[model samples]
Target: MRVISGTARGKRLQAPRGTDTRPITDMIKEALFNVLGSGIGGASLLDLFAGSGSVGIEALSRGARQVVFIDNSHNAVRVIRDNLNNCGFTQGFELYRNDVFRAVEILARRKTKFDYIYADPPFTVEAIFGPLLETLDRTSLLAPDGSLIIRSPRRMILPLKLKSLQEYRVNNYGESTLHYYRLI
Candidate 1:
């Protein structure tokens, strides 16, 4: 995988092998950042279920002030670390190897408030995502007026509405659907 734009444009990043990890295509990544525009600049991003740290690193490349990446797989964590180190991005990133659910719970407990929360859990695990993320909103884990961007396969059944938030846009690139949820 590679960073699609910004400071680290075209920089290569490793993706975990096997059938588990699916890196976002460069086209989709570019489109996502374009839609995000300058919103990424100086924003705090939390990449939950960070498979390859692709999205979070892209956010940083586009000038996001900081990013927190979470992934449970040892391979994913190692790749993220290597990618960050290669990009000289140590100062503004925190890589944590933890279960996505557990990390969410802990972050909520700690009152983490990020400007953007990107959730891209494995598509097959769709059933539990909505309720779990709704719980995050209920606990005020997301910052006021912040955005939650979710990438899921088109077949995944997820919520269209979340408290204080609304699904405003969806950009489809073949089998993947990138949903942009904003504060209402």
Candidate 2:
């Protein structure tokens, strides 16, 4: 994987040796940054289930002030660390090797709120999104006006109560899907 833009544009990143993470394609990354526009400047971000830390690192490169990455895998953590170091983002990042749910608990207890929250859990996690989102709400980790971006399959079902959702754009790229959401 590689950084999509900014201070560390084009820098190569390392990833776990298995299917633990699906790095975002450069095209999608570019499109994401475009959609994000100026919202990223000096914003704080959360990359839950952050595999290789690609997305978080990309946001940081593009001007996000700080990014907190949470992942439970050893290889993923190591890769994220190495990639952050390589991209010179270590100074602006926090890498937590813990369960995404538990991390949410801690961050919420700390009253940590962020401008952006990106969750790309494995396809196997599709069923837990409701509870997961509930956890986020209970923790109050998401800023009222903040956004949430979830990368999941198009076939997956989303809660209808999320109708307040500002946007639910979907893009199909090969076997994967990118789902974007924002609060109204």
Candidate 3:
């Protein structure tokens, strides 16, 4: 995969050699950035289930001030670091090899807030989706005006509203779907 725009435009990124992770497609990445537009600039991003860190890397390339990548796989973490170095993005990012829920709790304890938070959990593991959403709501991890974007199978149904957040947009990309949420 490659970065679609900004400082690292067209730079290639390496993914894990196995099927342990699913990377977002170029088309979907482009569309996501298009939807984000200038709002990404200078924003702080949190990338949960970061995989190869493609989504967070893209955000950094497009001028996000800071990005934190979280993933459970060791191979994924290594690949993300290599990709970051490849893109010459040595600063403004962090990588965490931990489960998403644990990462969330830790970040919350640290009082971290992100302007943009992105999540792409495994499609088959549907049980985590609701709890994840509720946890995000329970912790003030998302800025009041910030956004949380989730990628899931198109057929999967997620909550329309959380305690402090509400789904404002949903975009379908064939088999995958992007859900956008904001604080209510």
Candidate 4:
């Protein structure tokens, strides 16, 4: 994987060996950033099920102020760390090797807020979204106007409205789907 734009544009990133982690494709990443526009600069972001940290790294490369990456796999964590170091983003970010739900709870308890939140859990994990949305709804982890982007399989249908969040758009990229939600 590689960073698509900004300060660290074109820097190659390493992914964890095997099929355990799936990195976002360049085309989709570019399109996502295009939709994000100028909102990325100076924004704080959270990446859950971060995998190789490609998405968060891309955010940092595009001038985001800070990004928090969370993933439970040891290999994924190692790969993310190496990728961050290689991109010269040794600071301005935090990496957590823990369950995504647990990390989200801790961040919520700490009253952390992010301008953008991205979650790309394995497509087969069907039960995480509801609780995640509920937790986010009850906490201050999402800025009032911030957005949450979810990547899931095209076949699965996600909710359009969840308490404080409302679905704004859905984009299909091959077998994957991107769900864009914003706080009400």
lDDT of each: 0.84, 0.81, 0.93, 0.90
lDDT of 4 by residue, 41-90 (tens): 99999999999999999999999999999999999999999999899997
Q: lDDT by residue for model 2 over 1-184, one digit each (tens)? A: 6897799998998878887677777777777778788889899999998998999999999899889999999899999899988988758789999999999998987889889988888877677677766666556676777877777776876553353454457666665666666655
Whichever of 2 and 4 has more TM-score, that candidate is 4
Which residue pairs clash within candidate 3? none
Candidate 2 ranges beyond 4 A from true positions = 162-171
The superposed Cα distance between candidate 2 and the true structure at residue 149, in angstroms, equals 0.4
RMSD (Å) of each candidate, 1 decimal:
1.4, 2.1, 0.8, 1.1
Worst 10 residues of 3 by lDDT: 122-131
Q: Score every model by TM-score.
A: 0.93, 0.89, 0.98, 0.96
Candidate closer to the true structure by lDDT (higher is better), 1 or 3: 3
Location of the lowest summed lDDT over 10 successive residues in candidate 4: 131-140
The numbered model that scores best in TM-score is 3
Model 4 gets an lDDT of: 0.90
Worst 10 residues of 2 by lDDT: 159-168
In Å, residue 138's CA in model 3 sits off its true spot by: 1.1
Candidate 2 C-alpha error for residue 85, in Å: 0.9
lDDT, ranked from best to worst: 3, 4, 1, 2
Put down candidate 1 lDDT per residue, 75-103, tens digits, no spaces: 99998998898877878988999987788
